[model samples]
Target: MSPPKSAQRLENKWDASRAKNMSEPEKLLYRSNLLGSDKRITNYGGGNTSAKVLQKDPLTGETVEVLWVKGSGGDVGSIAMDGFSTLYMDKLNALRGLYRGVEYEDEMVAYLPHCTFNLNPRAASIDTPLHAYVPARHVDHMHPDAIIAIAAARDSKALTQQIFGDTIGWLPWKKPGYELGLWLSDFCARNPDARGVVLESHGLFTWADDARDCYDLTLDIIQTAMDWFAEQTAGKDAFGGARHQSLPADQRRAAASRLMPAIRGMVSGQQHMVGHFTDSDAVLEFVNANEMERLAALGTSCPDHFLRTKIRPLVVDFDPAKPDIDATLAGLADAISDYREDYMAYYERCKHDDSPALRDPNAVVYLVPGVGMITFAKDKATARISGEFYVNAINVMRGADAVSEYRGLPEQEAFDIEYWLLEEAKLQRMPAPKSMAGRVALVTGGAGGIGSATAERYLREGACVMLADIDETALAETAENLSARYSADVVRTVTMNVTDEAAVVSACSNIAAEFGGVDILVSNAGIASSAPVEETTLDLWNRNMAILSTGYFLVSREAFKLFRVQDMGGAIVFVASKNGLAASPNASAYCTAKASEIHLARCLALEGAPMGVRVNVVNPDAVLKGSKIWQGEWLDQRAGTYGTDKDGLEAMYRDRSLLKRSVLPDDIAEAAYFLASDLSAKSTGNIINVDAGNVQAFTR
Candidate 1:
């Protein structure tokens, strides 16, 4: 059954004066009503709506007020005054200059300090700068499932150009932050009369002098796309010309409840509850269809929707007549695992440090053969909405395909938006390490000790790791051990001296050529010297710097170049010693080289920020096992200086830290994992002490 003609006309009305004449309170209600009119219209806090309210500035004796924007965490359909963040128009415009050339996420965070207005309960939208760029009094942004479905399809640009024509401007996907705002500003400046702007792989933005005009423009564009889609695929059926059968409501609800907790756990601590089925027959029928797999591969309508709907649809393979619900649940669990592994491989092929690793599926639409579609969400309303969005997207995509072909935005472009700064910043503020799946990492000096441990940790977190060291035997052995435990192709080992510039460059180039790109780099290779200042030879100092300081510089520079050229922001980890921070007696050359490496990382952090790169240092205190530095004259002299037996000296070093435990390679690797993942997206130019608490020892 189609929507009535009156309903369609009501949906299309562009009543600018109705909003212009309404009071602020009336306008808020109208906005909410408009937001709720379509379910696939918006998801969670995926959309933004705003109104400019003018008021008198008593202190300044002029007319200036707030531009009320949708606050973070507030759904547009249910937002109130508290959900809107009010920013001074003049101050927002003034902040534009601060955004230029700002590259690092932290630097952008620092710009918040320059704001003159009270930030209040709601933080300013990440799109605040874009909103400010618009001269319009009102603006609206939404990830309308229909619009995104059309945009995400293969050949989306052509489809969009065909449908949107000269009315909308398209901006390529970028890591959204100040750069995105600047891009939009430039576009708006050039096209003063554009109806709206669409950020590829992101969403849509529309603005006008009146709130109603802005909202209606959004509706008109979406409706046009919808109508165009319906016409194109009028005869094509999504169900693959298959018949559906009905399933019982009680059985569907039970299955949904069983699936909720597993999916919720995948998203960390997000609350998710099962919603009741409204179309039990449609769901049962779809699930029973033979072509369910083909239907599920259409991909999401928008990249961001993965946060709520996951990357692909969940195909429930179960017989409703079968009484073994537990067996069916087990089958679902296996399917999820298979899905996660497939996702991990996809991530490995295309993901960079800044990308979002796969999480669990959020909503599942079960298509029972004879029944309709049963969508499961945290609540009834959301479930119903998700179902409608999925169905509409599927229908349109199928139709668009029939017309010509549907091609999505480029894979790399989608990755940029998926790992965008706006979203990565939110993940960074969380407590635990974010997903590290699909990242390729290289650890220098990854033989027996600290390096091996670091490689193991990265492998555990789903990274394709390369272990490089001067010791060929140790490197091969460690690689084999890790591979045997984790399976083949999990770890790759290459023998090379970090001090050789050609060797470092070749190693980096080979990895990038082999794996497509390198996302994480750990510069852990180094040599140590223990002579006093006067006794230290120039030759010894030079050699120490070559391996410890210069080697790090060469490798990091290569990594930086690869990251920039590939357009995937990468992460570099320098494994410096605690001696870099605190002075140790009778080790001048070793201390100096370590200290130099630390400073090198800080400098790179600043330089790399513009290109979306992050650089950090890990200072581990006296790791004993697998360290070549622990052998030969260096170890004996250091032990003698401490006035203790070799074992006693090692114990003293371990006791120096606050944890009072020996530092291990695993500890440093865990720290490296955090730095490489989304956990450290906002962290750069920072020193992480993996030395337990050695710094506290000097203070005491």
Candidate 2:
């Protein structure tokens, strides 16, 4: 449906207001709101925005500073000045020559010192180079829902040509990070006067000498596509006007639980998971309808979305009248398996790596026969966004079919773009400790010593952090203290148990709703228990696993969901101790749980790799300022074992590391920021040493 004329006028007025704004903050907020207004409008961290600011660098004299280009973790609507990583334009432009060969990530990290900032934060945007490459004073890149929908249709190229005319240039899909930057750099260099660039199976990029021009160009391009789609689909009977049926809330929840593990496994190794389920009558009935297969064959609107929605939706052939629930589930599994095998064959034909393929599909659209269509996501927010895109795609496809057949990217081409080398280059950039700005992070167990230090480091690096912990009093007090020092928004507090599934869900939902989606998730919530393996009771093991192992799973799960669905892919930092690698005496449960987390991070890294999500672990040794294991009896026990007094014992642990210093929470947090930012994009599943130099013992 076309947006009402009045709403269009309001948008126009807002655009005018934004154009008139000379203040940096106002322009930032304006562009953010514009990008956030639609679901299909932006992929999680898939797009970018920037504004040129006049600043005087100490040595560079007067130079334009890109005051803020949306950092890796920020959402357009909620991002602030702090969300943008400021860089001297001359330096950024000069670095163009520095980007060479396959080792971009390392090069970027090494160059972090060149960029001056009060806080040496980690992780810049993957497209930092692209933003730097653009000579425009302001730039906006987005994967607008309307554009993706149109682009996903059968004749995307023709449609694009019809709608955007010559103002936009279409580049076939390539992996996003470095290759994209390179491709864009070449394109911009070749066509200096081009208004924008559209990445096939990806999104759109717009730029101008001013912020307002770039913002309006994005809106105009998307609106044109939306209008073309509406015109093309005006009288399509392809939808069949089928409506979906709703299921009982309990059943829906149960179904979601059953699907969560598969979804988690699919996107494992990354942090953050956001899922949404729709059992509305229209969805269910349409899903279960006879023509469902025909409907499902319509490919994803864009290639990038494949990481989120997968290649196609799962159509469940549900028989609500079945007397045997187990049998029905078995049948569902069989059907899903068949679908998965078919997908694997497609992958095998194009497979480039020996890594096992994802077991869970990115999206599952179930057809409960008489019921409605239901979609599952890693997180609710993602599911909702996926649903929005699917609905729009369906509408456009149906409309196009009314006039003629719909077409999408050719299969081989789609695969090539999906596995493009350029895209791979983008994913491998290292974290820049000095360039991170305007990003937000949520560090669980923030009241703990490691968490507190990490939070402080993030604050120091110019990131807004939401510190969550089970210790409400401590969490609140810490947040208060941090707030007193930083901007009120820079530090917020949430008290919740990570073990409670509901709390995990609520926490993620609330964070996204409040801070736009978190850019970094530091899964540092854990418990330490030491007992002989033979003496460890089931209860003790279960409790340890619940908080230490399962808690990381829950938090990382939610974070991945959010990150996947948002425009910017986020970074996740899991805090596992050296014990995770090397066993400690009488610490079986603790070691086992930590080890599990490490493995989980590895899995997440693989899954998130294709989507710009980077996951890494920080193994800090003997930084026990806030750990339960650091207090009274535990301290005495550890000191006695080490044959020294408390302080001496601490030094013993510190000296075990190459650095010969206590690994502070700040150290871990700094590592976390690096992993979460552009600085560590290529370093997923990496085990970063925050433990000084304790690797020899751990390896031995």
Candidate 3:
């Protein structure tokens, strides 16, 4: 049967025209991509799809059934042909005897590799057997919110029968492994007419002989549940309706910005964590509801949800009426400590003798009333995905609580999945994190050569970057290019006139909102002036000081405020100039402003030392390539002073240096990176000269 046409909540996206010419495996990939593209169908990396095709065996020249399923740790939306694990169907079936019993089923995962066909390198997922044992040619396993809502409800088996009668069956909760695969096989054998079955507190599994039919069945099942919920939950208050009105959009963001840094600071004890904040309509509605806390305490039901968001989220205590951020800030330490204690207690209460040691006890998702959701992880992409998973849980809770009583996986069941030995082994297999994985940097003049170079250096080591610059067009272009190289989740941009206090303040807030807080501050915004003391106008001199001196102070002060909030030792790298120490002809104002920057770093070092903030300088001289200052009149003026033209000035400067080398933007960037990284942890209040060994600028 199809979803009822009159009440269908999902539109069938299949085009026979698109699928007519596709081979069996190609159709499997096409179907999987279509299902995964919409989050309503499944979350990122949440589901699997497979097709059984008759193919010639490599060793024997006879046709054999082969199971092609999605590989472990792969996302179906972007899965390539290589992402599928191919295995002999007969060999997979033989594994039914290898399974000793339900208690020894996990050991079956170790035997999956022996069934590999064609020496395929991709590892099969634990759900591989579930797909293999199904009698149909194509199978779809998805965690759609609508179906999961019904599956996670109280007496979900009764709910399933009422909704789809005998067509769709229901099974009690079974930990996914070889044993669960046998259950599905047995269910299909007994009820040959059933199209699918919902695994309680898990997800849906649907199959059909035809690829297009399987795709249609999966969507139809989800839409049927969706349509039924719409009818049943119509005009019903979701999550007991709104207990607190949502604050205005701007105020919500303001509150998020105010609280994010302090929370980031308190949680970053080992490796730092980057944060993601979302104030979507779903998040706002859920956060303002009266039953929000009660429902959240029950935790998420789906295994994939707990894999990303943990057992539950920590609900931040904040009243919409009061809007007292300071009060919330004062209580964060205790709030966070209490959450940690409770998480440890959970581990103690439910852990098995051989369970993997308790993981980070901190909650990945944080819910704030009148604001939105905040999530933190080792990096920006993970943090963002964690937030997305919790939103999925929020949708499931809203639907289940509306029609039937919402039920979460029991605490012991959740802990079993959470601390499963297989899950822990998968995590252990991950590559070591990049040096700057969880760090955040705010780069001033980020569109300029030195600024962009420094930002890239940090990004390569896995830091989140906020590119702040006065040039809006250039900032956008640079951010776009950097984001393309790294995923967009790690790079953000803000426009600001660094000399303006208000603009600097806003830039700081935007950066904090974008990525928890600042770990590195690269103060590089400046303009070069080429004039004798007599020719230099007061406007020109003041302009130089305004950007090069006061501008640095404004941005630095804001960064310090975040550092203080985080209570984390951070790095401040000032891109001053060789002229700050060595004399330069016809550049008094430029040299004076540069000198002011150098002194400022030293002063900051004295005050920041107690808090573990290291202040240092990278003094670069005659960086001709990609320097905005050198692109303007500064180049011609410096050339004229040296009795050479613009083309000859770079050569003249290179020859004038002790090592006779022309310093480039990358050279300065390297020095800036060293100062900002832990490599220079003990060298605060120091300066590194990237001037091809200019003797006069040497710090020693």
Best of the candidates, lDDT: 3
lDDT of each: 0.66, 0.65, 0.91
Using lDDT as the measure, name the better of candidate 1 and candidate 2. 1
Winning model by TM-score: 3
For model 2, the local distance difference test gives 0.65
Give the C-alpha lDDT of model 1: 0.66
Clashes of each: 33, 81, 0
Error of 2 at 495 (Å): 24
Give model 1's TM-score versus the native structure: 0.51
Q: Evaluate residue 278 in candidate 3 and report its C-alpha lDDT on the 0 to 100 scale.
A: 97
Candidate 3, after superposition: displacement of residue 693 in Å?
1.7
Better of 2 and 3 by TM-score: 3
- On residues 20-75, what C-alpha lDDT tens digit does candidate 2 reach at each position? 74586467567766776654466554567877777655555655465457776677
